[model samples]
Target: MHEGTALPGWTEMLVLAPLEWMELVGERLCVATCATVAYGAPSLGTPRPPAGMDYVRAYVLDSADTRELRALVEARIAGLADATGARELAGLTVRFRRLPPEDYASSWEKVWKPFRAGPFAVLRPSDRRALRATDVELRLEPGAVFGTGRHATTRLCLALLATRVARGERVLDAGTGTGLLAVAACKLGAGRALGFDIDPAAAPHALHLATQNGCADRTEWRTGGFEVLDAADAEFDGVLANIYSDILQAHAHELCERLRVGGWFVFSGVPDDHALATRAAFDAAGLRVETERTRGRWHAFAGRKPA
Candidate 1:
């Protein structure tokens, strides 16, 4: 179910499977899990499943590797069928259709509707969902980079931001995918927000999101990593890093240094099993853990630099 501009040369693939199989499939495929129902998009239509089969829909991004990806997915489906002894499931089907070039943007609009994460509600600009008086609505568009606030790691970070970001503070968001966190910080009344990512493609996407949220003037997006954090530029009152566990562990000391004493620091993207070690690394760097939250198998931690 893709809704986008009629762009030529892009293809969208849809896979339908039992709801019970989605977790295993997501872990194996390395794409979003249960994306079909993650947002508030109105149901396009439900596919009829076999007797007693509860179905969920998922998507594979259109990319150069898609063909190889489909082959791997089909192979996994075959293995699952054999393991479950459900021979009928061996023939799991996937749907593919070419998207018109102009429709690409509309396609994102169709899926990324308004959804709440703690006090924040992430919505596309066109979303009409009712909002609570206390809700901070973040309007964004899907981008090539991650961090749209849908993933567990991003949500945990958002929750911390909502609680800890004071008015008129400075924020530094490391590996700012889609620039969502930086924009969210600005929306939360941060005087200035700076974001940097290793991916060269991420700056534009993050900058665009900052603009979409009307915080472009308060946000700066750059491409690179910790090198962007310089003493001459000034330390931040809040720092966010939603990158992987290893990177966070590796840079724990430097990240803590980027924040002023008593400032907030939020780190996520650590799997639950590694949370303890990640926390210890920060503790060693003089940051004291103040909050920890987990969703699914991912863990998020919020700490503060000791004054």
Candidate 2:
């Protein structure tokens, strides 16, 4: 479930979930999703040295009904032991990709132009302005990470954030890749906003956007993994995590813990096929789905902790 070095056979997990799971596992855990029968290493990153005969882990769930689910999952694996369709094999196994850390660099930019949304103004560094239902002000910019206002996921998140970010509401952007969501929350009337990202490039880019959006004081940025999220102590009126699927499921617990009662959590960056699984995980975490928005194959779900 965790590792002390860069994981091996991580890319194969991409078969089971979207690319985001690797991000969610943070600096721990190797990847081997249901999509793959055998494990592999991440294609990127400088893989760390092997753990020396410390074999990776494999787990099998014993729920009565889950046997079917496991069978359904294992059937999708690329290779397998004579499965004989054994549902008992329904579980995950990650093989350490005996390597060093690889690098993941996001190529994004800011767009500074006159954009209008309702009576408000925005900078449309992303194509998100095109999806606007009402005229709002915005500026565009290049970013380190992709998917700001221009991406469907980000746009959907903005639409939902607009409705809930009342004046003085505290906001958090869990995977603040570009800090766009946090800035949007601030512009939408949130009292304050903070962002965190696993990638080091995230903070500076996000801070720059915050300053450009005139929310320098309203938005704060941090560097660290989800574990660094402990700084939040169940604070935040709204949270946004526009990450891929596997990581989303892995962090479902931390996300629930970080949200305040009656607060909202917006999740995006999921592929269409994984929406139900993602929703199921959120429900299992005790968060209530208040709104659902989808564009193309991506879905943005808004949920809340019980008030």
Candidate 3:
């Protein structure tokens, strides 16, 4: 799902399973097809499933391997049913159909409207809505990469960045999916911003976003992890990370060391179950947690390096 790519024809895989097994079936389907799975939900005009049965669907490119992939999906489902003793799954089968191609390029433009994150107004590339005089508008194309400012964690980070970023300060965005935070930092008056992610596809998408937001001159994107910033003397006035809790804990020290004394940081994507441990890791890294925000089951933290 890279940016600016045409929507190719797809082979849709649909399965009907009991409500209790839908999630499990979806997970196995994702593992089998290496693609996103969609669980059916009743729409306003759509009828609900029969009793406890629900529909799970996944898609694959309509290519020569479609038949082979279908076989693999069925085998995986059978294996999962056997392991869990779910007899219903063993008897279930995948219904494959070819999806007609349409103008998906403009599909998002029709559905994705402008949204706000603190003082910033997040909009898609095609959105041309008017805004307030003080609005800091960010034009972005999510393109399969993360951080559209719609997620709780991303919004939390944006709010923190609005309050913490200072004029002319250098900022670092680790795991900078879509480079949303880095672009936001530049718009917030940061003198410079550096962003890096492990996914090679992230760099181009992020760069495009930075350019679209008119912050390309102030931001740099790389296609690697923390190792990309290997310079020993490299330091930033602010750091942002919206990554998993376990990865945050593992690299807490490295991330903290890259921030100058008295520098600020916003860490997010920590589930409630891992909030306490993540906070402990931040503390161990000498980051004094000054603000904590919780939305739904996720937590985000704003803090600074102690002298």
The number of the candidate with the highest lDDT is 3
Ranking by lDDT: 3, 1, 2
Ranking 1 against 3 by TM-score, winner? 3
Error of 3 at 262 (Å): 0.4
Residue 239 of candidate 2: its Cα lDDT?
79
TM-score for candidate 3: 0.75
lDDT value for model 3: 0.82
RMSD of 1: 5.5
Which parts of model 3 are misplaced by more than 4 Å? 1-106
Better of 2 and 3 by lDDT: 3
- Going through the candidates in order, what is the number of backbone clashes in each? 17, 53, 0
RMSD of every candidate to native, in Å, equals 5.5, 12.5, 5.3
Off by over 4 Å in 1: 1-106, 128-130
lDDT of 1 by residue, 1-307 (tens): 3545333354444445555455344443344321222321114565455554544334443553366666765666557777767565577665555544544434555555467887888888877878889999899777557776788789888988888899999999998988888888888899999999998878998888888888899988889978876778678899999998889999999998888999999889888657899999999999999899988678899978997
Top candidate on TM-score is 3
lDDT for model 2 comes to: 0.61
List the global CA lDDT of all models.
0.75, 0.61, 0.82
